[model samples]
Target: MKQQIPLYLGIDGGGTKCKARLEDAQGNLLGEGLAGPANPVRGLALSQQAVLDSTLMALEQAKLGQGQLPSVNACLGLAGVNVALYANQYKNWRHPFAKLHVMSDLQAACLGAHGNQDGAVIICGTGFNAGAYINGQLTEVGGHGFELGDHASGARLGINAVRRVLEAIDGLCQHSSMTKAITSYTKCSNASALFETYHKATPSQFAALAPIVIQYAKQGDVHAVEIMRTCAAYIDLVVERLQKLCPPRFSMIGGIAEPMFQWLNKASQDALVDPLHSPEEGAILFARNNEH
Candidate 1:
């Protein structure tokens, strides 16, 4: 009887979505899957379900069955795992994979962006975080979660936009096209309606409004531009701090990274390089390098 070749799974699980990639032992791509939000900080049960859902989808796409799960090795780069409590809780999950390795999404992104070489990465997505790997040491900054930090993140931008819109509606501030755009997007004609719409909004739900802010900023709306400038300033600070680590390369990623680039200072703009791979691929490299 011949032995079966090993299968590997790489997962990049973030506040907005979870992505999975399946590869053969020789590093050939097999299948991929995407699922909903998987940040444990938001909800541990939801995160776990997302991971499993994406993995099963990948398995099906790879023409494999659930029975093959025990033959697969998986590495998960997950958002919110930087918190010790969430990290330990995820590490103890009764997962279906043959072996599981877990790490923060920022670490996996840096590895992927720099091809597992020494580098730094700033993720400006639904949440914000920066990480650098240099000389076998990993340095991380920000990512304190939505309630506490996540400066320059989409959630922050969205919340700021909403605040501006509300102030404009209430006659507390001058209204602009940006505020009008936000009210239109939210279908809210008054402060009371807007408040009802977002009083219990999740980070991802807030992030959904960010594109409107970016669009208005691009159109030269005063309030939108001011918001974007603030966002850029925070990102600039993050870059300055990470550059002190002196990584050979640096990359900015996530949904807002490109749009926010124009608003960044020249120094921060010049410091960035294009990423070589996706975070999911970074998870694969991590799994391979750490496989026992």
Candidate 2:
């Protein structure tokens, strides 16, 4: 009798986007996919659809059919999975796969960064989140969502940048390079107009401005520097807390990580490490070890 080929699926689901990767037993990459936001905290229905859509895209790229899903061991690392309410609700939630593992995106990043070894990861992306893996325990901080927390996240940085620009216009704070950059980016005549236009902007839209802030900071813009510094401080706090729980091997992950890391203190920089693999690989690692 011939042995069947083994396959695995790994998913990194976040507030901004969902990513999926398919690989054979030997860990050679087969295919990958991307979809919309998959943060369950925002809406479980949307999250479920995003996950399914991205996974199917990967399977299609791998020239596999839906029937193959039941045979493929899968792991999903999702944002908002750290919330007890969401985690509890989704733990027993139905999925298409025969075997599946679910964890927070931060946890997946940690596993990916350290390759299942003891370490920590701070995700400073569209949303902020941190996690540490020590021995067998996984602990997380932040990532409560924009309205609640996510202090060091891209969304937050953008929001702060906008606020500073508005203050600058009102003569409440120093007007610097960010004022012009933010005004141009928002395409608003003035700070008040920007505020009005962005009163209901989406997370992705707000996060879009973070790069502008970082750019100005790179040019020695006073307001931009302060904003970046503030973000760095928030990240530093999370790293400090995680280090207290786990080894100091920290990897900064996500869109804003590099810019933010540049502002961290020397001690924090000393503890920094590079990730061994992507979060998708971490999901594969989880699937390999946890498949039923």
Candidate 3:
């Protein structure tokens, strides 16, 4: 009689963190791990390191050594994998496990939400992006990046709120509590300091200020509240665009998903569906289904 070889591993690489799951061939999830962002767009070395770190963590947790891991296949659904900026890194990843497959972070989100079924996903977290699955094709709706896009993401929230505060200080906009909140969050003493801080600081750190905006918005601060409202509008725009493009079933993902949900238009909210699983689970599902 022939013996069955083992297969396992699923990874969800995000902007905030990476999640790795170790499952048996029979589909029993055995171990899991968490680590920093694996978005290749963030940096090649950073992204690869994130994935490697998180995957190793999971294996260690699962009590599976490298020899055991090598027997298991892996599928990495990584954020920013679709972007061409990190193309060089995408071609090469350090993984002892075989049967490796690379896909965009949003691809796993869509699959996780619908179990490889046709669907769309609206993700709002540190960054905002939307993707669709139609007839096995990956079609992205938003996700233009943090500069002028990512309008509905946490990074966008921080950038927009701070900019509003800066504008208000110049008397171009009305005074707002957000001005103080922004200053406090970044630990900038004054306007000049804030400008200097921006040039020296990373966008990821500024994006971390999103929680402050969320807090103020909940407290009814007008500018802060506007940030949330505006965020919803941008996400809704993507949903509407995806609807026109594919009109498939859509689900939500990410940390700020609930906030986006709360502020979405009633019609948009009505169209939402519950996610069947997360990107991590979807990556596992991929590994399980595709036997090496």
TM-score of each: 0.97, 0.92, 0.91
lDDT of 3 by residue, 115-215 (tens): 87888888877776788878867788677667757888878888787788778878888866777878776787566877887755544766788888888
Ranking by TM-score: 1, 2, 3
lDDT of 2 by residue, 1-292 (tens): 2214678888999888999999888888878989998988878988889888998898888878777877778889999888888888778778878788888898788888888788889888889888788888878788789888989988998999888878878889877778788888789868567868898886778899999999999999998898889888887777778778857477988988888878998877877888888888898998998765
**lDDT minimum window of 10 residues, candidate 2:** 1-10
What's the lDDT for residue 12 in model 1?
92
- Report the number of the highest-TM-score candidate: 1
How badly does each model clash, as a count of residue pairs?
0, 0, 0
Each prediction's Cα lDDT score? 0.91, 0.85, 0.77
Candidates 1 and 2, the one with greater TM-score: 1
What is the per-residue lDDT of model 1 for residues 77-142, given as tens digits with 9 covering 90 to 100? Answer: 999998999999997899988899999999889889999999999998999889899988989988
Ranked by lDDT, the better of candidates 2 and 3 is 2
The superposed Cα distance between candidate 2 and the true structure at residue 29, in angstroms, equals 0.7
Cα deviation in Å at residue 138, candidate 3? 2.3
Relative to the unseen true structure, what is the Cα RMSD of model 1? 1.6
